[model samples]
Target chain A: MSAFWIATIGTSVIAFVLKYSGHSVPERWLSHPKIQRINALIPIALLSALVAVQSFSEKSQLMIDQRLVGLSVAMIALFLKAPFPLVVLSAAVSSAAVYHWL
Target chain B: MAFGAAAVANGFSVLQACLLSLLTFSGASQFAVVGVIGAGGSSISAIATASLLGTRNALYGVIMAPRLNVRGFKRVVAAQVTIDESTGVALGQEQRGIDAVKKGFWYTGIGVFVFWNLFTLAGALGAQAMGDIRAFGLDSAVPAAFLGLVWPRLTGKFERILAVSCALFAIAMTPILPAGLPIIATAFIAIVIGMKR
Candidate 1:
């Protein structure tokens, strides 16, 4: 009835189509050189953009705050090859500290 | 992260958040939906932005299809849980042989589906009780988890450069673009560089 419901249902349908179509398409097309390259790189680009936006932006404006501090800490933990949950915990703890102290 | 945001920022109900996780099963796209709605964007914009971000899962599907041959109803189940965690775990188990790969995919996919839904409900309820999500710094977990996901993949010089450039490109576009569009725009960078290489 509402736009929110419609959007939710629409997103689900779109996701299903995308996933099922992956099986339906000829295997050759999915493995094209260009497609493979794009596939390899898209995750990196998408995840990096997610990190940047989540860290620095507030709504539509570019603002920095505790999130940046959290990200910085998480980046270091990641660089050290820490466990995944530990990296997340380090970031959350650092962010909580920033929120409390700064 | 997203379920928490949906609860605190958008004032979404527990049902709404859980249904979203169940149906979409995409962390990024679900977050984009809430971000778009929280920013007062139209539903069209919300769905469009979410779909654009989800296009990558389709790519994942392509990569996983040959690796996971299925038929009939099993295809539907596989399609539902074909997410980053499942695909990543599946590929990581490639060395152990085909059985291991299948086990990895099913275990991760089912595990994430179950846990993600359960935790979404928990996060929604927690946000409802806490009243303010900022103090806990749960908001930052979205990006932090993303960073955790992407970092291990960037083992080489070129991947590192591409990832850094894309992060900069996304940040630079934040002020100019709408809430969810900046993330979507990063795909162009990958496309261009992917073409060049």
Candidate 2:
């Protein structure tokens, strides 16, 4: 099999392990303050990294473009506590509009 | 939902996209995988990054295990549907009772699972019909949606700073690192801060 398939299978397997381990493992082990703290912070950190890479980088190069505009608008909407769908729509529409102009 | 479209837009086959939604069932990690692959990154990196992102679900599983109390086939089914929406709904129903919590979990979990898969199929088909993803600027939707997802989570100064620093760090490392490693490296910030306290 190809690397792509290998990668996909590996990811699926690990993900299953992560999910399944929850049921199998003892709860006290996972409730440690440090583990809890890491869990809480990981989402914020990982999501932010995704936002940066997807918006600022294109094919591994940092390129400023309409995505930046869309991200800015979405960030503002999110700051205002806008609904998820609304924030996503505003970002898409704003980015599409900017892409049209450019 | 939107991820299915994004995956298709990234040049994945419809079957591949649906299989991802089916087998993986985690939206963010699935997106990360497709995003990495779309950018010509290696498969190993894609899997590693996605699994790192998915570690939280295991945390969620831990929280739900006692409350769920299933066995055999039901346990397997419960595990598959154990996601954010289900957990949130289950917790929300805590005021009612245990039965309510179970209902909430099962209903929300099954609901999202069915709808998510159906919509994923729709999105994949729609992307195929559209033919030109760039013209619609659908690419931007990925980051936009992710930003929206994380937006509410940044509830304090410390969290906000940590998020911004991670993003900047990933961007900075892009030039020096390989395709998918920079994102994986973002974990260091969380690790450092998490270990500090």
Who wins the TM-score comparison? Answer: 2
User: lDDT tens digits, residues B1-197, model 1?
Assistant: 44554435465667778788998888777876665565545677677766766776777777777788987798888888888889999999999999899899989999999998988887778767766556777767667877887787798999999899888998898788766677767777888888999
Please list the C-alpha lDDT of all candidates, in the order they appear: 0.77, 0.82
Each candidate's TM vs. the true structure? 0.86, 0.95
Question: What local lDDT score does residue A75 receive in model 2, on the 0 to 100 scale?
Answer: 84
> Model 2 interface RMSD, in angstroms?
1.5
lDDT of 1 by residue, A19-76 (tens): 7787667777777789778877877887788788777877778888998888899889
Backbone collisions counted per model: 0, 0
Q: What is the lDDT of residue B142 in candidate 2?
A: 82
Q: Which ten residues in a row are the worst by lDDT in model 2 chain B?
A: B130-139
TM-score of chain A of each: 0.84, 0.86
Q: Show where candidate 2 strays beyond 4 Å.
A: A2-4
> How does model 1 score by TM-score?
0.86
Regions of model 1 farther than 4 Å from truth: A1-7, B1-11, B35-49, B93-97
